[model samples]
Target: CVGGSNGGVKIEVVDQGIGIPQDDLPRIFEEFVQLEEADQRGTGLGLPISRRLAKLLGGTLEAESLPGVGSTFCLSLPAAHPTG
Candidate 1:
């Protein structure tokens, strides 16, 4: 889902896949940090890169999950203004 408010835009990516454990949620944004419970193998650089890009753009990348239920990743950015 995506929406925009007066200050910024918010985008949420939700998945019904196996959810992450609360203890490990924060590690997902770390470089090359892959969870053993993952269904497939990955290099684990995606989230880290995504977070860095978000920060560079003056935005934020975050996540929330419940084990065995699902996960949600949210990206929020400030409203952009046109410059002459």
Candidate 2:
């Protein structure tokens, strides 16, 4: 179940916890975005920072979820170019 085309170990975060709501999902990655039901504990900066970091590292981060089901986040890095 674990395989990669990149040289670096991809870090995946999967959670079935109260999957993000359709409308909320899009804004969750924005700065200052937070869920009041979550006690507003979310700073909303976390995702943004993570995305920025991934971009800086030449990687991509994606998220998908189903309400009341679960969520899957993939942080994929570029495959290491083999050096002779």
Candidate 3:
């Protein structure tokens, strides 16, 4: 994780598995949406729920991917300051 300009922190989750397709990237965070190759049993609610939780915490979650290469999911949140 790295510090953001606004006194927040950015955490990145990177994966080297098959990357997401450009066409499907936009909907990846939607509820009940899953990639064609994803496990058939998956409910596809994880990402959407995660994004909602991030927003509730005054943070943001985003993703970047390259087909056949890899993907990265980033979560940025406000940093906590220690009290004296």
Per-candidate TM equals: 0.86, 0.75, 0.81
Instruction: Order the candidates by TM-score, highest first.
Output: 1, 3, 2
Model 2 segments beyond 4 Å from truth? Answer: 1-3, 6-8, 80-84
lDDT of 2 by residue, 1-84 (tens): 133464665778899787887777777678877766554386668998988887887787778888889998888777766699
Question: Candidate 3 lDDT, tens digit per residue, 1-84?
Answer: 333557788889999988988889989899998777644568889999999998898788899999888999999888767899
Q: After superposition, how far is residue 52 of candidate 1 from its true place, in Å?
A: 0.7
- What total of clashing residue pairs does each candidate reach? 0, 1, 0
True-structure lDDT of candidate 2: 0.76
When 1 and 2 are scored with lDDT, the better candidate is 1
Higher-scoring candidate on TM-score, 2 or 3:
3
Worst 10 residues of 1 by lDDT: 1-10
lDDT of each: 0.90, 0.76, 0.86
Error of 1 at 29 (Å): 0.3
Say which prediction, candidate 2 or candidate 3, comes out ahead on lDDT: 3
